[model samples]
Target: MVDVYWRIGMHGDQSTLRRRAETRGDWAPLAPGHLAPGWGDGHGDGRPYLEHMADVARAAEISGFVGGLMPSFPFTDDPFAAAASLVEETRTFRFMVAFQPGFVHPWGAARLSAALQQLSGGRLVYNVITGGGGPAQRWWGDEVEHDRRYARTAEFLDLLRRSWAPRPQSADGEFYRLADAYLPTDLADQPFPEIYFSGSSPAAIAAAGPFADYYLSWLEPHTALTEKFTAVRAASQALGRTPRFAVRIDIVSRDTEAEAWEVVRDGFSGVDLTALAEGRDGDSVGVARARSFIDGPVRDVRDLEVEPHVWGGFSLLRGGPSFGLVGSHEQVAERLNGLVDAGVDAFILAGVPHLEEAFRVGDFVLPRLTHHSPQGALS
Candidate 1:
């Protein structure tokens, strides 16, 4: 069996999600901003903030999609606040909120997640980030060396796990301190919200053992994915943990393969070439990884289609997860199957002009995916 997920709305133009929904079919839209470039103004104030996220969440439910990803960052709307507002507006649609160790206290974070879980009736998913962008780090006043952030995150998650346990948790780590902290709420029946993390650093891989329900990855070819997954599994095993796999991807779907490619080509027009270059130039692991793809043996970032039905053009603008699955319904299904064969269990997929892309993917791709095989969501 295989599990395939899609996220259509990501912070972008105001009407991107709605327009996509109207033209295509019902699909999920991840809230825009936080990590999206060109979103925050020169003053570092984010536009299309909570209002845009609420609209996208409302539209996703009304229009018929799964859920949205709520990103956490000082510059954008708070993930918890954004998700809390959408609880009543959406029915089955859930919210995936991003978090990092350095930003909030572990006890406070656990309490926040518990409240959200209860309010949304257990419709909360947490994405753990290790602080990537250099500018974003400056906002939090966290200037730890690259790998150290992951080390601190591991400590953070350890405290978080203990906080959620039946007995109060006590921890005294270099980065965090907790003394018999325990949540008053009882969630005996409903499970705690799932945790997600993505990183290629050795420390990040090593940290997955402590707390990770879903291990996330950027868009990579099948061969690269195979190698990465093998290493991640080994790391998790050494730590006595079993983590599921997921990949973040943009998508281009159409009635036929040719039509899908046409949509992919059209998306290039929306790229902010100047901002893209600036973001790429910033000192961050994401930018360096993107440059390696473009400047190395893969001379052109555009040549990053390591497998059929996968494209890396979006990586040209952003970092971390910068690839898209491009093809017709069936072709998309096959590519997804290839990833499943490589041990990928979950997918956080999206597309440009989000609204229409959501419908195309949800209506066309999801059904094919379900028919091909069906599996449970991230446990």
Candidate 2:
């Protein structure tokens, strides 16, 4: 069965206008001649950072999600630190902490992953991310070309695996070199965290086949996803390995299809076009593919229906993983199940306000889908 996971927000609150206004602060008034609604102007509930994170973590855990994905970004709190802090907040749900390859040395990453696995009682997973694009790469002082980034990532993963081996191991790769590196803390037979990797480029697929335990893709049409899965499967087969497949996407499910569309319209009503354009101007293959959906014939909010239930309205506001499934609960479930039929083994999903939507999906959609329990072995 496909295992389902939720995306945990490490930044500001993700509530809608009504919820934010009720719990946070009053909304700003719309000015004359403005086409968008006045939102995101409220003073939030003033919860401490840790307190908010704990609430989200507990909600997702109790809601039957297998895990939560904590992303690594220049702006958000450090994923490792946040995951470590959140370990005590939840019991069963795993934390897929995003770790960039070149940002830290492979030895350090292996050590950190081991420590986190111990600390969380084997509830840690690693989402290995190669730098996103030119701007984000520059921010991290990584000037390597696109393909070289994946090459470095391949070397990094190779070293990380060796570093976690029971005995001391060493590696001399193009981007990393280590001599007799070993973790001091005993893992006590605990396996290393599962490696979840994401990239759409050829270099990424080439690297992923050798190392990735789960290959992740942003939401795309069934045809596109089938092609990608075939490519990755073929690449991994060449190496005598078969990596599992996973997908990450947003969801806006409601009681009825019309209600879901209403929610989308309201959510994007206040979107800033300039900010959206800036986000779309990324060089990554994933970014380019997502932008293509919006750049096609469906160029306006009213035309975001890319498929029966899949919506590209979010692509106008966000960059990576911008597509979303929007419809009634049953409709959304059908779309997700279709992906599962097409070979997606896992789903990493999120909505605008994670806390509430975790419950919504857990109570409504999850029970309707054929999914594994949190502790069940993934297929």
Candidate 3:
């Protein structure tokens, strides 16, 4: 049976939005500014983001989510700093931090990972993000070519392993070099934290082959997913490793299928098609791949629905992980079970009104899944 892991994608809510939503005692809000300018609550206000992450981590624990995924960007709070703060405030919930190769050296990242693991009592997980947007890369003083990013990523992970290895260690890779240096001798019995990466590009999969513990991706149709996994598995096999699979989805669960679709309908009622088109056309390789799939072979995203309960609306609007298995609790479970039929082992799902939707899914649907398969059903 596959273990069902749940995490919330708490991408920032604007400041005004945060103020309104914070009325709930259980709600804690995070804003922009902790990382870079031009993001978060105030439009370009230089407010720090640590407050938001700390608040969200507290709320996630209250909401029954196992952890919070801190998105990495020049425009967001530094994930390592944010995680350190949150770990002190919470006891159980985990902190998953995203990092890109170009932004931080592997040794520096490994050091941060070890410190957080010790400070948090093993509640830290690393989200290994290969560089994505061309513009974003330029902002970092790096004009990395698309495919080369993944190659660097592979080298980065190799360096990390060497840096954090058990004893005296050294490694030389195409992108990095280390001398006869070993990690601090005090750190023992330190398990390598879970590594998660997302991309549809072939180079991305090949790069992730040896190191990633969990291959995360944007939700795709069942048929398309089967093919994607086939390639991923083959790549891992070529490296003589076995990696688990996970997905990020935006779910809308209601009492009935019709009600669920209505929630989706109302959510998108204000979405400007023109703006969405403009954003989609914006140059992000991840978005480009997603857009290509939607417009290319998979012309209409609706056609990619593997079951009645599953819908690819989010994928259409956003890039990477966009598809949500929307419907009644039972219907949603059935669709999720289908992924188990293929080889998916974990799901990281979220919704628009995150806190409330999490309650609905956790209280209602999670129990059914637990009852049906106490040890995790998707075997």
Candidate 3 per-residue lDDT over residues 192-272, each given as its tens digit: 688887777899999989988989877765566677788899999988999889877667677887877665565455444
Top candidate by TM-score: 2
Better of 1 and 2 by TM-score: 2
Best candidate according to lDDT: 2
The residue-level lDDT of candidate 1 at 285 comes to 56
CA lDDT of each candidate?
A: 0.64, 0.76, 0.64
- In model 1, residue pairs whose N, Cα or C atoms come closer than 3 Å (at least 3 residues apart or on different chains), thus clashing, are 7-349, 9-29, 9-30, 11-32, 20-355, 20-356, 21-355, 25-359
> Candidate 2's residue-wise lDDT over 1-379, tens digit each?
7778998876544355222221211222333321122223452433346565667778888888999999877877677888888897789989999977988888888887888888788999889888677777788888888899899999998888888766788778899888888887476256788888999999999999999999999898667778999999999999999889999978888999889888777766766555444554346888777667665454355676667777766755442366789889888887887777677889999876678888898888887786422221121
RMSD of 2: 5.9
Better of 2 and 3 by TM-score: 2
Clashing pairs in 3: 30-52, 32-40, 34-49, 218-321, 315-322
Candidate 1 to native Cα RMSD, angstroms: 7.0
Q: Write down the TM-score for model 2.
A: 0.87
TM-scores for all candidates: the values are: 0.79, 0.87, 0.80
Q: For each candidate, how many residue pairs have backbone atoms clashing (under 3 Å)?
A: 8, 0, 5
Candidate 3 local Cα displacement, residue 197, angstroms:
2.1
The residue-level lDDT of candidate 2 at 22 comes to 18
